[model samples]
Structures are given as C-alpha cells and as structure tokens.
Target chain A: MVAAHALTVDDMREVRAAAQGGRFFALFDPNALIAAIARSGDRAAFAELFDHFAPRVKGLLMRGGASAELAEEIAQETLLAVWRKAALFDPTRASASTWIATIARNLRIDIARRETRSRLSQVYEILDEEPPEQPDATLSGAERDARVRAAMTQLSADQYRVVELAFLEGFSHQDVASRLAIPLGTVKSRLRLALSHLRGRLEDLR
Target chain B: MSAVHRPSDETLAAFVAGQLDEGLALVVACHVEADPASRQRLRDLQAVQGALLDAADPVAMASGPRDVRAAGQGSRSPASAPSAPEAGMPQVLRPYGLGPWRSIGIKVAMRRVVVPDAEARVFMLRAGPGIALPHHKHSGLEWATILSGAYEHEYGRYAAGDFDEADSSHVHTPRVDPVEGCTCIVAMTGNVLFQGWLGRLLQPLVRL
Candidate 1:
C-alpha cells in the first residue's frame, strides 16, 4: 500500500522526477511511457503510469462526494480508461493531469447521467461567442506553483498526506481508513479537519 | 474580472473531476470568468491535486500482468470522434421565437446540439413571459445554466449564468420570469423523466 501521506515539496519533486525519470526502462518523459505502452504493451510502464495517477483520480472523485467504494471503482475505471485509451494520450492539449481530469470528468458525468436517467437533456449547448471575460487574477503558472508550494508547507505532515490522499489521489474515506489501519470515521474526521485547515490557509493566498 | 459567480466547492470539486454536466459547466465557466475568488479556489484545488498526483506511490502489478496493457499498446481502431465542434454556444440550436416548451411546462423557443461521439448534448431555451416548464424529474444527469433572463426552481431564482444540476432524483419546474422571458442552456445525458402528459408528448422532442 502507498504511504498515506502527502510528500513535502521536495518529495513531490522527487516523485515527479521518478515519473519522468525515464531511466527505469528507457527515455524519461510521459511520451516514453506512452511509447512503451504502445510499442511493447509495457506492464511496467503502465504500472508506473497508474501509480502516478490512480490516486489523483481517486482524489477527484472523493472530493466530489463519492463514497470510498465509489472512488475506488472510479479509480479502477479511470486506469482502465488510461490503458485502453493510451494511444490517445497526447502530450499536447493538456498535461497528464488535465487529460486524465478530462476523462475523469467525462466519466463522472456519464455515471451521474446514467444514475439520473436524463437522456432527454442536451449535452453541451454551444454559446454564440466565447465570453471575452477571463478568470480574475488567475495565478501565473509560476505563481500558482509558488503559492501551492507555500500552502503545502503550512500543512502538518499527517494532515498534508490526508489532503493529498483525499484531494489529489482520490482515496475514498474507507480507502484511507483501511490503508492507514484507522477507523472509517476517523478517516472522515481527519479529512474534514484537514480540508478545513487547508481551506483556511489557502484563503490567505487569495 | 467577469460577472459570473463561481460554483460551490462541491461543484468545483465535481468539475475538477469532470463530474459537471455541460450546462452547469458553462455557468461555472461564466462564474470563473466573473469571479476571481472562485477561480483561484479552483486553481488551488487543481494545484493541490497535482501535488498529490506527484506524491502517490506506484502499486505493484502482479507478475506477467500484460493483458491490461493490451488496450493502450495494441493495434486498435480509434473510436469515432464526435462531429460537433467543441462546446461553445452554436447557432444551430437557435430557434426563432419560442417553440412549445415541453417538460418545463412553458412556451419557449428551444435549440439543441448533440456531441458527435460523446455521451452529452446541449439545449438552449427561450421561455416566454410568465411561462413555466413542466414539473419533471431527470432520467439521467442534467444541468441547467441560465444564459439570459431568469427563472425560479425549487432552489430559488437563477439569473443568467446561474447553474443548477439535477440527477434522477431531482424534480422541479423553472417558472419563467413572471413578466420577462427566460433564456437558458441545458446539458443533458441519458434519458429524461417526463412528469405529465405534456412532458410525455414532448419527450420525443427532447433527445440528446
């Protein structure tokens, strides 16, 4: 089981480096992983890829209020999507997170629609024009990097990890509980507290 | 920067994970354009998510677990990409004057667009004065974003760019502006639950 904690900024950089290291089998980069999955049906590459992402998918689902079981199911489904659609993984358009997020978002929409049985509703209505307005004071990519890093620094190690697991990796409350060998209620409580704390701290950056 | 209101954290979380319907998403887009605070929250959420992704440990696959890799690596024909252009307001769904508003129990002009390969569709509505839609629940997930005018549902009044999401369980009728007409965009997936005879009759017209 993966450690139930968020890595410090330096640690995160290391993991990113490992993901991009390409030294494990061949060239480092997401492209290599895509190539490996394409050229050789590389289980290792896919595993590496899964290791990096499944949690994030889980995080997204969990934050959206899916139960732990649902988050796990979604994570597995998302990984399967990554596997089946590996060839479609283009580095352009978005990074891996954006691409995966798109798939996750679509999948969630599908599940939500399926459950609701709303076939009569339209999908995305086209607007006449792209609104000229832009997001207000969007953090520069670099500033975003800095602020997030700074935010992460404020979290206690345990709280940070829980936040990471719940938000980034999509670990369901149950999953986190089990992984940490804690009670499910404890997991939920921790998550609630951690999110509350993070929300308070991140607000300062705004 | 923009006049749009940001979505609630719960909705933003859903959007970040791709859970939002298109109409709801459009409203969120409008809000993101209008509200910097919500935009920053979304960005922060995304950034934190990125950090967590980088930190996750790789799970070990069973030995000889190659079958799972087949879909990504092996020769497989791509699914047909949807023919419709990417999501933005399109003129195709525009209707001159109001057609009969079906489920919502109002007289409204309606236009629609279906995504090519994706499991989503979009609808635009222009409800006439004092019109109200039928009271119906959803068959699948549904999203409504007010583009112009305003309407009231169980959740209260929604003005242009206000978003509401409904699932199979929700039921409401958006009463058009008591005086002014209401224009809105809706994104729907799966089927719709038509509540009354009018809804049943108009059900056929409401297709994704």
Candidate 2:
C-alpha cells in the first residue's frame, strides 16, 4: 500500500520522479487503492489517496487563479468527494488521477459559478449540470494516459504553451495571445493545430 | 453523428475548463449525451488537465479540518432525481421545469426553461419545415443544440445531435430542413439584434 500520511512537497517530487522513472508500478496501484476503499471502507486507502492528490489539486486550483485559502478548501472538498464516490470509480473508464482531477476541477468551477451568479444574474444563468456519464470503454485507462502524455511531449513549445494557458489557466484565446505577446490569429491557429495533432494521435484508441 | 456540427476547439476548451455559462454548458451536455465521439474528445481534454495537475507546483496549506471520516459521511450523496424521460428532453435536462410553448413567429414556437441563478436565458425553439428565422446578430454568445431534425445556415448544415455556437460577429438566417421540422435547445447570454429593414420593423415584437 502507498504511504498513509500527508506528504511534504519534497516527498511528492520524489514520488512524481519515481512515477516518471517507471518505478510507480511497485510503489502504488491506483485500482487496488480504490478497491480497498470501496470494498472495506479502508481509511488507509483513503489516506493514501488524500496524501497524494490533495496537494496537487490545490496547486492546480492556484494555477487557475484561486487564492491559496480557496484552493486548500476546494482540495479538501475534492478529497471528501473522492471518499464519498469511491464506489463509483470504474477502473475501465479513467485512471485514478484523471478521475480525482475531474472532481477537483468541477468543484473549483462550482465555486466560481456561485461567486459570479449574482453579478451576472441578468445576463447569464449558472447551469449546475451533472457530470457526464462513464467514459467510452474503448482504450485501457493506462494506455490512454500514456498516449496522451506522449502526444503532449510531441507538441511544439508554442503549441504546448497555448494549450497550457487555455486548458490549465482557463485563459481565452485573446487572453492567451495578450499574455504570450503573439497575434490573436496566431494563437487561434496554434491552438487549432495543437488540438488537431493531439486528436489525430489519440483517435486510433477509439 | 460523425458529420454533425460540433463546438469549436475554443468553446470545447472553455467547456472543459468550466468557463462556459450554464445555458451553453447545458446545450453542450445534450450534444455529449448523443455523441460518443464528443465524449471521447472530452476524455482526451480531461487527460490533459490531469497531466497539468500532476506537474503543478505544490503550495503548503495550513491544516484546517483533517478528519476525512467525519466530513465524508456528512451530506455527500449524489443529487440524482428519479429518471423522467420525456420526448426531445435530454436526460441531463429532466430536472428543470419547462414553461409552455408560445408562438414566437410564423410556424415557430418557443418555451422557456427555468434555471436558477443564471444570467443567460435558456429556452427551446421549434420551427416548421422550411421556416426561416429572421436574420440577426447577437449581443454576446448564443449556443444551440439540435434535438431533432436539422437546419441550414450560412455556415453549414446542422443535424440532430449537432451544436451551433454563434457570437456577435455571426449574422445569418437559419432555415429548418424542408423534409422535417427542426427543434433545438438554445442558451443565449444576450439579446438577438435583428438586422435589415424587415428585421428592424419586427425587432420590438420578437423577444429572442
């Protein structure tokens, strides 16, 4: 089983490096971890997941412009959601990281919508829609995850940066262009090319 | 479904990022429900999100409440309502109450969908075969998903399960398919500004 206590930032880096070094298989098994929580309500499994994911979720929220306090709060909520929804996690659909990241992203969005609802109430209504159904079971979660990582590495620096800003930072095309000191049309074309490339690379899995 | 209209990459990115307003997201959800390809695309986008999260620099947070067992047991049930399948209503939309269909123009009917705490207006529009909507531009973003039948605009043909995203720059008159009438769910962030002499004359009468 993975370690059960909270990990410091340095410890997380070592874990991440190990994951990159192909040592992850021996140290952690996400499917087994989730199964433990699902089958026996194992607090150790929950702790392992929380220790690994909570800090990463907070970092992601902070990158998306959330305050530190807000990020921590959302990260806590995300892990709680993981515990509550452990039974629903199907290893066939998505990897553990992908599944937990989605919960964190959705919770952050919910908080943002609640904050903006009143100010934009006359112009737009917040739609608190449910999450999409289980992903198509075409490719194994590990295979898809590896392919995506490979495809991302193949992208040109500019293309990658545009995607990172747009997806990770939630910046609009215009905003990305302004931030990168590039023309708006260039930003659009680069993003378009990047998406097409990623799609072309990942389409075979379907 | 493969040939059906899809939202642009920018819109898809925004949707995945949770930046889209509720009304637009609803229409996109309906499209996703009907298209497996879109669902796959969503998964790919989500994988990118996962990678970014993994590589993100962690910041130390002061410990607040660390009791997962206590917090996890309190009120974390999925807010799923009983399935109430309705014709032309996507499963994601069954929770909201819809108003009565009112005549908006010739052979066109519309019904408002109540979405709380939303600034964008959500509604459903049904147009008869060969019916042409007035040419107009939008003040902000306008998103629509065809529920049944099809429509042809200046851009391209949009069939059932297709999504159409219109901004202030778009100005076109969409005509329902000649063989079958078309029905679409739409969420608009702002009012539609009618164009031309006839459109100006009828603008005050048309609310959408």
Candidate 3:
C-alpha cells in the first residue's frame, strides 16, 4: 500500500522541474495535507508543509514589524503550534495565511502581556482577542493585493519609512529616534503625519 | 466617527510587526477594535507586506537528499504548560523593562528600557527645573503619561493621571519644575529630528 505521505522531493521531481515550465502546481489543499501528515506522523509532509508556509509566515511577521531574527523565531513558533495542533487546521475556517496570521496575533498578544506587566497599574489593560473573521463580502486575495498596493503607493518616502520601521522593525518612536539620532518630537510628528497620510490613501481605496 | 483616532505611523508599524508590548498593544488594539478606519490602515500595511513577500527573489532550498527520518515526538498539551499566574511577576514584566536613567542634557535624565521581543522601548524621564527639552518632531506615534511631579508642554500643562498621545506631526519643548522634579513614562516609535545647536551637540547622547 502506498504510504499517504511517502512521496519525496525525488518523487515530485517532475513537478519541481515543471515549476519552471509555467505549469501551475496542482491545487494542493494545505488543510488536507496538514491533516494527512498529522494523523500518520509523516515527516516528509511536515517538511513540505514547513517549506511552503514558512516564507509567508516570515513575511507576515516581518511586515508586522518583527526583526529578521524575531520573525524567524515567530515563524518557528507558529509552525510548532501548527504541529502541536494540526487537528485545528480546519480548512473550512480560513486559509493557512489567515490562520497563521491569527497565530502571530495571539503570540503577539502573549508577548505584549508578559512585557508590560510592571507598568500595568499605569495603563488600562485593553485586550484585543476578537479573531479577524473574514467579512461575508470580503474581496478576493487578488483584489486585496491591488487595493493594498494602491494604498501604500500614496505614502511619502519618509512616511513609508516610518511605517516600515514601526511595523517591520517594531521600533517605537523613541526607539526609532534613538536609532536614527533624531529628536523625539521629530519622530512623533513624522509618525503622526504618516498615519494621517495612510488614512487618506485608505479612504481613497474605500 | 468617534474621532477616528488613527494610530501613528509608528504605532501601526509596531502593531503590524507584533512588537508593541502587551499593555500598549492592548491599548492600541482596543482602539483599533473600535475604529474601522484604523483597521483599514492596518489591512493596507499588511497587504504591503504580502506584496513584498511576493516580489522577493526565491531563495534556493538545501540540496542533496537525506535519509527519511521519523516524525518528531508530540509536544505537551496546553494543560501541561505552566500557567501564566503561576510564572511569577518577572514573566509579567517581560514586556516592559526597569529602564536605566541618563542625563537629558539640562539636568534631565532619560533612558529607553528594553523588553525582550518588543518593537518599542519604554521611556522613563526625570528632569529638574529650567530644563527645556529640545525642539523636536516625532517619526511615529508617542504616548506620554506623567508618573510624578509636573511638566508643561506647548499644548498644555500635564500632571499625574493625564495621558497624552502625539502623532508624528507634533513638536514641543517640555520644561520641568526643578523644585519637584518630573518623572514620566512615554511610549514612542520612530526617529526624532532636533532643531538647534544644543540639540546637535546632545544629539548623540539623547537620541531618544
């Protein structure tokens, strides 16, 4: 009997070779793959799963402002979470990116909670636990891609940099100022103005 | 239309990067949860990240085959992991650090304390009387709350219990009352550009 995940890269060599031939990969369902490997303890499936999703997870974390090292760490943690809870990969619920994004979000929350406990009394604790439920009339991935690109294009270089540093590097204004050797006021103004600009761009998209 | 308080560029960036500490992230997340306009901005930035990922050149995977290894052993369940309330206080303080104090040029002390994996640092400032912090602008968002004593900013006077958030476009000089001395906590992202001579001289030491 053929093992559920016995196919190796060698076995899929024809497909890998065809990856360069403008041939589309079969619409492999990530959830089914995750389930199959998960139930059978198939390492090959796990490796394939990691290879396909790790890059995107890294991308999301980096975009969210994690450093390359931090992003790698989060990505690893996310996959481990996936491995541990592979049964939770309900394809009907969300795409892998969305699910992974949710994982990143939760981990982010866990980290934030742990870090800011000392000053707890000073600031009101506001937990954002609501999942990013896909809206009933949500746009397709391609539409989202177009809309987001259009919105991003409108920000100024400085604004874009501020956004990138804040989200991608996770630098606070003071941290950003310290790193760039600028004044606190300047950092604040740039970020403020950048957000306003981003808002305007988004308004245009809507 | 509840003021549609948009997150400062830095705040948005930090949120996207998953760097803001828990307390602050919660604060911002609460705001985002209530504000749809703000949520749109977040989605836009996330998409930008997706595009960047789509655009980057593919890195080659490791070559040469290896023996097919068995799947790793299963991990412990959530119930097995130590609970949060059980981890003690330091785990709680993992997001905000006990920062160091440094001179802020005019008899003021300032330092950015590090918390592991945080995108932003917590700022603790202690300034004596007659110290006017340099004229500067923000690169991202800033949240400042007074802890002790009092200080006057261009916008208005702030005492204890008053929390203020400044977007990237605001500029100001903070003058402290020496008799009481001022200690405040601020969360900020992005760089600052100092305006004058003293600012230039102290630029290296007081980058934040």
Q: Who wins the lDDT comparison?
A: 2
- Assess every candidate by TM-score: 0.50, 0.82, 0.47
Candidate ranking under DockQ, highest first, comes to 2, 1, 3
Measured by DockQ, the strongest candidate is 2
On TM-score, the stronger of 2 and 3 is 2
lDDT of 1 by residue, B1-208 (tens): 2334335554565455443444445445544533445555665665565555444443322222235833443332232222443344323232112234344443655665433333545556677878766676767766766666788878787776566666777777768788767876666666443445335644677642
- Considering only chain B, report the TM-score of model 3: 0.50
- Segments of candidate 1 deviating more than 4 angstroms: A1-136, A149-199, B1-6, B19-38, B58-106, B116-122, B134-141, B166-173, B178-180, B188-192, B196-198
lDDT of 2 by residue, B114-195 (tens): 7766657778888899987677676777788898899999999999899998887887688889989999998877644345
Interface RMSD for candidate 2 relative to the native interface: 5.1
Model 2 chain B, poorest ten-residue lDDT window?
B73-82
User: What DockQ was computed for model 2?
Assistant: 0.33
Model 2 residue A26 CA deviation in Å: 6.8
lDDT of every predicted structure (CA atoms) = 0.54, 0.72, 0.54
